[model samples]
Target: MLAKPAMAAIWVNQYTGEVMGKYDRPAVFKVASAAHRRLFGKSKAEGAFGAITGKLAIGITTIALLMIIISGLIVWRPSKGHVRNKFKISITKGTYKFLYDFHCVGGAVSALIITVCILTGLNWSFGWYRKLLYSTFGTEVAETTSHKTPAENFPAWDYAYSKLSSEYPDKEIRMYQNEADIVVGGCGNQQATDTYKINPANGEVSSVTTYEDKAESNHIKGWIYSLHVGSWLGWLTKIIYLVCVLIGAVLPITGYYLWIKRLILKKCHSA
Candidate 1:
């Protein structure tokens, strides 16, 4: 597919950290970010390609999955007095029944988590959906702040880095000198915090905003990614999400087997 190579390229860049040239990484990221901006009106922080083909593939897959869940719910509803049976798996009912219960019951249990993944994944691909989410949640998007300083009079990167590093000694800090301001950003052992602005004029830490100070919308946006990847609650939640994803991955294969068996049985019955 057109998008698979791009995905692989991104995966290599992320997990392997291999670059073709001195400026290869940033150049690749810039191209991917431009593609995303053209397609979705925003750039992904990770700089993955989220252009037309990728977005369409994910969007269609998400819709198909939602339809499957809805249809499964309709077909899975139990008779009024036998409601409990719908949730129970009976291995004693033989192989076909066992497979049926595994597919249905496991799917039912994991549906919500899978749905969350789909929705969050779609949000990453669709700008309209993201805008709707922001509006519904009453959250304003954060704007990047830049300050310009005279080229000849700009403070050194070392000075800004030293001042911010000394202030946040316990935290991990990354500093860069822009044309205007020396921007320093850091976080604790966990999530990334806000960017700290330094006055290039006097080498003073001018402003600081932590994660807690961000708007409700921004918080939700951050949490959406965490929840989608099962990182919000640490390793325990990640384990749970992993299991759910595995179950989801296996459902289609099992369902296809069941369908094929049904077709064979119907042919025998007709004969």
Candidate 2:
């Protein structure tokens, strides 16, 4: 069930040139992202069923994973004399033993990585959590004024786009027009780094805010986002994160099997 969405996300990243430094995302990535929206919902905007489902899934899975890890640790307390054996797979003991060791040890090793992924995901899933995160970073969400603009007097898209793009040659600019202001967001190296507010009527730049110029907390927040998606350290960390996610995907299946096997063996012995 999760396989398709995971693969699609990886596919989108592949085309977006995340693995490489290039930003030339192909048309196919749009299709893949659409599929992602259909599966995970449109993440940025609200009111989509997919988005609601995705959030619910994240919350539930995070709790479930935490329980599993804690319970497993409690049940897996090895004697002091053989404590070291818990970390090693004993292939000589047979397939079942090897699998049991692998599942236990592998899960223990990957627990921290998976926990970080889950907590970060939850931060995006819940509003209160998001607020807390922003507060911890010494920033709050930007507030937009509800001022009105006459339709006939609205700013031209091309004019705003061109002006902002020319001003920030090194950054990719995306323009937004609302009743209150003409806002231009500038992204460099794949993350939004700056914002510009332009006067709609005269196309004059009124204010500029650079993310990097903000407090250290803001930088920490940005790093958290990059780390969540495994893009912080480039290809190497991405590969490691990919592996950890794959292990996370398989843990439930392996755990279920182990449980069922234990039940069967106990029944047979009792008989």
Candidate 3:
């Protein structure tokens, strides 16, 4: 993702009706090169490349959606022979059934929430998406990241768990490692929807909490996260998310083969 921006920047600076010598190219590259230097130290090229490729995921996702839409349209439209024949292939019927199912069913199932997630994530990856979702959701969430040094007096996770358990006696603490630099503290009710965050360093409760305090609340969004990640609700949500992801993944593979089977492979077979 960062790599896409860096590469795009490099291309724009180099071409875009601009003229420059090799010396100037290195100088222009230096702008992106500095981000590289910061991330990968002396290995400037790798840093720049990483930034671009990370952001490139959104572009790939967008392209995938476009392909699915086109394939879906082909599946939806009628064949030329249909008008002349009394009985013909329905848009929803055929021998290459999985292909149509892959595009239509898979797409209809995953399109809404996944698209929102992807589009918002693209904004999130770029900083703009956070603002947009936050604004639209009409909630002021603390999206800002914070950090604190581990306490010398206690283990961070143990401290967090003890503190959270004491704070909400009914809640159970679940501490998870979040990347290399951070420890995540989660507290949820034993049989309820409420979740809270705790700061590992000082055992102080953190403000960036996610929970369903009562029935019929913003926890619907919280449930979406649970549904998406398969953590909050139960085995059912997990299985549903896993199956949806699998279906979504298969769409491209099956759709591609379907396209080739109809457009190219079938021709070759007949010939």
The collision pairs in model 2 are: none
- Identify the runs in model 3 with alpha carbons over 4 angstroms from their true place: 1-52, 59-95, 116-120, 139-141, 146-148, 155-227, 230-232, 265-271
What's the candidate order when arranged by decreasing lDDT?
1, 2, 3
The TM-score values for the models, in the order shown, are 0.67, 0.62, 0.48
lDDT tens readout by residue for model 2, 26-99: 65775566443344455332333456775666666676877887787777767789878888988898878878
How does model 2 fare in lDDT?
Answer: 0.61
Worst 10 residues of 3 by lDDT: 179-188
Regions of candidate 2 where Cα sits further than 4 Å from its true position: 1-54, 74-84, 135-192, 198-207, 215-221
Whole-model Cα lDDT per candidate?
Answer: 0.64, 0.61, 0.47
Please state the error at residue 144 of candidate 3 in Å: 2.9
Candidate 1 per-residue lDDT over residues 113-193, each given as its tens digit: 898888777776567877776677777543433222322223454566677667666666654343222222222113335
RMSD list, candidates in order: 8.0, 9.1, 15.0
203 in model 2: Cα distance from truth in Å?
6.4
Better of 1 and 2 by TM-score: 1
- TM-score for candidate 2: 0.62
lDDT per residue (tens digit) for residues 1-271 in model 3: 1222333322122124353322223545755554322322333224432444545554465546756665665555546765333223235676576465556656656555455445533442344554555556665433322232323333555566666566667644444432112112233211233334555465555654333333332433343344335554466545766776677677778767777778886788889
